[model samples]
Target: MAHITIYTTLLCPYCHMATNLLRKKNAPFEEIDVTARADLREAMRAKAAGRNTVPQIFIGDEHVGGWDDLFALETTGRLDAKLTPRSD
Candidate 1:
């Protein structure tokens, strides 16, 4: 299975949208809620390179940025490609 990770908050609409899109693709993901966790929130900002925003996503080890980036990947039909684990 593909390792999809998303840092999100309960009140963030963009995070919900991102998760919704992933659900549409039948992709399983780990949703880390950063609302109540200060450590995770700081980690998200660091991992995202100072982008202190909700919904920092990662497909495997590749950092896919925020909701907009994920949407772009979907629109370009590359989301599935990234979601598929390599056999070789």
Candidate 2:
């Protein structure tokens, strides 16, 4: 499986939804809480190409955006492919 990283805030509902979906998929992810850390938030923004939103997700270096983006992937049945590491 691809390594997952998500930048989130404690009170964000979207973040919770995103995490829940990942849990259902049995995907192990590193959740980085950026609620009280401006530096970390800035880092997330930089990594996300200036998308300074809660729940910035990355799957093995591929930026997956936020909850909506992730959900779209799931709904379109494209998420599984992303989660599986390429054998190349």
Candidate 3:
């Protein structure tokens, strides 16, 4: 399976929802709580192109954006494709 990583905040509703969807899909992910880690906040911003919002998601180096983007991918049926393990 592709590795999932989400930079999240402790009390963000979108963060909770994003994680929930991943769980429902039975996907294992690395949840990095950036609520308290200012260090991580800067790192997340750099990678996310200044998107300093909660729940910045990445699927094996592919940026999936925030919760809404996640839902869009799921609705369009492309999320499963992104989650599948690549032969590389």
Candidate 4:
């Protein structure tokens, strides 16, 4: 499984929705609550290039943007391939 990291705040509906989608897909993920960590929020901003939005996602070291972006990837039929591990 690919490593997934989600930067989130407790009150964000998008964050909850994103995680729910991942859960429905049965994808393993780690959630970092930026709400409680000022440093982490700063780091997320840097990593996201000033996008401080909740549900900022990272897939195996790749920045995957927010919930809409994830859904867009899914709609385009690319999410599954990325979620699966490649033997080569």
Best-fitting candidate, scored by TM-score? 2
Give candidate 4's root-mean-square deviation (CA, Å).
1.0
Question: What tens digits encode model 1's per-residue C-alpha lDDT throughout 1-88?
Answer: 6899999999999999999999988999999999999999999888888888889998998899999999999899888889997789
Write out the backbone clash pairs for model 2.
none
Query: What TM-score does each of the candidates earn?
Result: 0.93, 0.97, 0.95, 0.93
lDDT of 2 by residue, 1-88 (tens): 9999999999999999999999999999999999999999999999999999889999998999999999999999999999996799
Ten residues in sequence with the least summed lDDT for candidate 2:
79-88
Candidate 3, lDDT over the whole model: 0.94
What TM-score does structure 1 among the candidates reach? Answer: 0.93
Candidate 3: tens digits of C-alpha lDDT, residues 1-88? 8999999998999999999999999999999999889999999999998999989999998998999999999999999989995576
Candidate 3 similarity to native, TM-score: 0.95
Q: Could you list the CA RMSD of all candidates, in the order they appear?
A: 1.0, 0.8, 1.1, 1.0
Distance from true location, Cα of 19 in model 2, Å: 0.4
Q: After superposition, how far is residue 35 of candidate 2 from its true place, in Å?
A: 0.6
Displacement of residue 29 (Cα, Å) in model 2 is 0.2
Better-scoring candidate (TM-score), 3 or 4: 3
| Candidate 4 structure quality by residue, lDDT tens digits, 1-88 | 7999999999999999899989989999999999988899999999987898888999987899999999899899998787876979
